[model samples]
Target: MQVSYIVALLALLAVTATAQPFLPGTGFLPLGNLRTTDNGGPYNISLLTVQANEIKGGLAAKQNFTDKDIVHFLTNVECLEGLFDTWGTFGHGFNNNLTLGGPTPIGARKANLSDAVRPFMEEVALNEQGHALFTRQAGSDLPCPPIDFTGGFNKYFGAAYNLTGNDTIESKFGAPFDPFLNDECYLLSVLSLEELGATGNKGLTALLTNPVIANGVAGLATSATAQATVQRMLLWERRNNTVYPFNETVQQVFARISALRDSLDGPQMDDQGLVNTDPRTIAVPDYYVNMIPTDVRGLTFSRTPQQLINILTLGSPDGVGVFFPKGLYGAINKPTGFNVSASGLDSFPSSGAKVASQLSTQQIGTLPGPMLPPNVTGELDLTQSLTGTLDNGTAATRGYTIIPPGMPYFSNASQVAVAYPLQTGSSNASSNGSYAYGGRRFF
Candidate 1:
């Protein structure tokens, strides 16, 4: 019976895959009618190799695991996987449409993009399936939530740009939110999603207590993080490789996008037609982008699972409820703890040059975005920004030191969250508590 249902779902997905090109203000018919909030809902996977029959029972049934931790992990994984599959499909469809090499059904002109971009999307699409398989094999039973592509895009871009149509209000740069209609928009979207995927994967790995399962989960996270770095490098190279009207660097572009919220002073859209001609400042707020470029200095940020879910689901109740509907997220039980750090004061390169430029020409390099922080060796200090206490008096400090490969050294101090009552700091003055963990710092 399960086999039959899987077959039927795949067939439906295949049929819907042929739907017309995506247009702003339009909604694509979702495949399964299963409510995202349901417990026994259908898993959104169809590669045949990952048929639902192979899935183990829910992770909460796993041996030697606490019920609360398992439930929380499963809930978060379900939401993350749904978003991954949806993002992959969105990317796949966009790339497939670009291959049409003509005017699309939505009136966007299509041209042959660089060879690098297409294969990247293809790999990302397939990689998402691997993530789905990983979650299922780990005994996650959460249902796959449908992705509202149009709504999701609007929620993201409308907040960032104050316009959502295809070259309607302004014709200078084409559609502000339509990736299919604009190549720059497509690349930017790719960079953003890939980076978010990497962060989400890494953050989730820390909470996986089972060593056996943690190995696989960590591998997936590393892969996602590597892909994100590659996307960042590519974005930088693509911009430098070509001359455009706004021949700006990646940092400049990021700055412009970050400035979009000055009009709103928050992370929601105003929609009052107060946009300016700078092409970056919007009348609304982009909580996601705004959160990305924090004003804090010398430290990088990674969202806890709940924080990320809020961004992915468009602040909740407005989109799929993968993490909501009682999946298990409370103030005390965050999906994962914060753990970020750097080697020492000398760990950051002295010149503040981009990470890519410091590497040997033969060595692979990553951009110095918040996703990958500077990792060097010297006297280290946790920045004031990453440390604090929550409104409820819970210690807010959590992070891992970012360091280069083979260095494997992070002698720094952090203030552990107060919820862990057993924890005692080595000192009360400048040092709190210092610990070391094993892993190659990809930064």
Candidate 2:
């Protein structure tokens, strides 16, 4: 029975996955419906994956070791198994739609395809999953290192690589031009290349031959001034400096997006006005051309080889993990407590540089775009709280590290909401101190 449900759910996902886009090249391939808070509720994967039989069987099956062996579940399935693309960047390079360059209003805000898919895929994006996977596997082994977090405070924009002379990747995001890597822009940009297949070594070459780019391509401007237009778009993106748009729109930007908001969410238009002007499909504007440049002299689209969207999204390279030698901050997934290596640092900088270059590559990368109410965590029903003072007489907080009960990490922005409570009076104060273990980070 449990197996039946899993099979059924997979079928449903497969079916719905084939739904026609409201517009052309509008569905799948680009970001899917995973990330929208409102839209994703009905299709919540948690609800979908839950099977009565499985849960019952998980605990019984793995009586010795299982989150619930009734059904004997495998808690630590490798993220590699979930890899859809050769490079594993959202499994891009397949027959997916190019993120449409238009507003898709859903409720209070207008979202692009990328914005819409975020809520659904957020957890499984592999970026967070990497940490979770590592932590889940961590045990007696010299203790796991903390997550590498680059303290992104969002201030001061348009600066050099590093004021410290090391060209360290300063949060790379700031004000004025919002949607820093936090937005779905990267997803939007990436989905277009989904059909490149598992080993898309020649995917870019195929894209070039599609007739949407330089010399002759769809959505690419056939006009004589097309080259200048592409150049202008590139310059605009550089000026904006937001590769992954995170912040919402400004007055003017909002107005542009506003026109389509009502129509997108409220009514279903038969006409999905996504302009498929990619050089592979048709003549496009300099916007598309410069944004997704295919015309490298003497090079075919397949030769350029579009990197997997995941690579573009989360930064690339399979083995060379990011280096935090100088003690990084709390934003960019900083591998906590790990001794940084120079070779590791040197090797992956190239991949990081590629992602960096790709991000601010075109004007449109600048665009678009959290949470829930929680669950069970209580020490005891009684008034007495679990408190033990340190030998130095310094009282410790109720929960250790404020890392949240189920979670391993603490205080990172994404997980900041899970706060560790402070018991004021004394370690054994009244033997009764109860506070919300992990709620939204208020302070």
Candidate 3:
């Protein structure tokens, strides 16, 4: 049958179903006619098919969304592409400069700590690249606009580090601050990026319609959250081993970065361009919810395309910023809500037998100086970070006592293994794909 016929059949079946929440006016957002003709083109159809299968395997999961809502969603995808690209670029630069089994740079690698930082940085780069690719595949019209990673870093870092105008990465750490040099500094910066992505994906996932696409997007968001949590765990571990150079706690630093973003971005707006008086505190529906914990409870913390635009474009109404390009911003309707499968929402799967042990302590050695006191306990309770309860109990949160050995969700092989532990039977080397693990592998 033709694709249109299939879509028509699906629509007909959907309409015939009783009490389905999909509204009467719902339609597919036009993927063509984007703000710019710069998009490479539609993503690989095979990949889409794989994504569709993944979604189906993940189980069936839609909304009164209009063409404008679709536009808003696409626009958000474009912005995410740019943001993740910028972060990936920064991660590469950081990994290279750190001399972590990569190219050399102007300054010395901080404390010769290649092993600790390089792998994590490289993983982050790949994960970010995957995110950007998925965003494009999902339905992005515009190309990733140019972003000044250095300038954006300086702005955020300056706020968090209390650095003066003259003080820069080179001035403070013997290298430019944009890509970062200090190990802790890189950790903190990446931490913030991962957290932003994690939360943003949660909100965006709720807005999706296709179950396959929704599952793919939710996988991206879950990886981001897992990465962020790992960063926090590592930072805490470092702090505990000795009096590290940085004085602030992980929570304090993350809060400072968020505050800087809010202060610079101004008032948050919803999909319909309505002013959000309390953007940080606003609630989102249980669509594509994140199973991991966050600061808020009772409501999923959400950021609409407009809010993302505000922060990424640095409050530019026209989507133009010194660091971000104007074309990156697409018109969005005022903020709205959508419905998704409450039971089948995105969640991090538990660990596997290969590395079932909870993240334990290790001596990371001392830094150059003892700027702060050691945290021998290393027992900073991130339980609060992982717990939130909704008012209506539509969604519940799961907290972890320690970081897992591997990233979670369906975005990766290890994650797939963990997500569908029942599929962990013996296999031949040639049979590499996780067909048992919900058919997540696209190829």
Candidate 4:
């Protein structure tokens, strides 16, 4: 079927054969000798399509799963992919620059962007049998990992939101944003892939629809470059630029919405061509493949890193601050939705995370200067930036204040660095990728 399992296989670093055939064992993991048992469980996937349609009589399996067979079955169940990649970042609000978010240098462009490409572009814009398995494999390369699945974004300034100093883009979310990166959701995913390549529509009505491939996703989503590949694929395509390059029918509606969103290998469906959902009847993970590496260098990538520290350190080498001094932009907060509040996980760098806990968690450990001193965010620094104006005028001096626009979380963690947003047993800053801790050990 898979060409007698790829003509009895031979490459892919060669496991030789027995890539199938292991049997007996489920919860503890094993039943694999290539069928006749263990679909991992939950009605063992209708005896795996009734034993692959009694070994191909009724058909279906000329080719099925791939992201290279879930990265070779999670590298043959050895583990260590950790859902998303770049191995979790760490560059908090202040005290940064040791290389900031690591893993580039060898020639940049690999800055991270695989939170499953925005829930596989919101299940190809909300499902319909995931748009017919996103039109039966629309393009290919497959495997849509996003790895984990946190979602929660767009707090305004875009990506992770930032206002640095002289901040512009029409002062964010109000309009303007074309210093490049194009906005409006990258121009509504590039005019919706330029209207699906001037009207091919992936063969009609997009992604084939099955609620967009059972929400794991596999179609639509295309920007297919013409210009700005975010500064030319982050300097020459190291790949992973917030994962857009999509195509093979939007990577099979994001591998069929990561195969109905369920992983750790129960109903696994990544590598695009998904059908998942069985991590004990699904808790979540059919469409989140954000690996985030859209080409990085000295920092300033956006998609949220405190909006690149509010547009390059409060609008820096010198755009000026004290509330945009002339860049002017204010009022939108709507409880964090106008975006750019430092980079979102609530502004990072705060190890303990517990300060009675709540000013909407920008965490706030050392800010004062990156621009927040207009009455310390006393709710109205429309950003004209004389330094946003301070003394106690506050554009963000750090004692933790800003809670006015629509206030919701983070009044604590001690204004930015005190305890537990997952510092858990306590320890942090092993360099970037979120709280890595000095000695670092989240493997």
lDDT, candidate 2, 270-355, per-residue tens? 11112211111112232222233222111112211112222211222231122111221112222111111112212332222121
Per residue, candidate 1 scores C-alpha lDDT tens digits across 1-443 of: 99976875565355334322223332221111111111111111111111111111111112233533443343344334334333433532222321113111221223234566766655655665666556557665544333333344435544443443443212443323444433454555555455455544544454456776767766766776666555555554544332132344433443333333222111211111111111111111221112222112211223234334444543443324322333333221232211111111124322211111111212212223353334421102112111222221111100011123222111211211111112244222123222222211100
Q: Which consecutive 10 residues in model 4 have the weakest lDDT in total?
A: 76-85
Winner by TM-score between candidate 3 and candidate 2: 3
| Global lDDT of each candidate | 0.33, 0.22, 0.38, 0.21
Question: Local error of candidate 3 at 316, Å?
Answer: 2.9
lDDT by residue (tens digit), candidate 3, 359-386 = 1112112212332234422112101111
By TM-score, the better pick of 2 and 4 is 2
| Model 3 / residue 278 / CA error / Å | 18
lDDT of 4 at 254: 28
What is the TM-score of each predicted model, taking all chains together? 0.40, 0.19, 0.43, 0.17
Alpha carbon deviation, residue 53, candidate 2 (Å) = 55
RMSD in order of candidates: 25.8, 28.8, 22.9, 26.9
**Candidate 3 TM-score to native:** 0.43
Better of 2 and 3 by lDDT: 3
Top of the candidates by TM-score: 3
In candidate 1, which residue ranges exceed 4 Å CA deviation?
1-113, 162-176, 240-301, 317-443
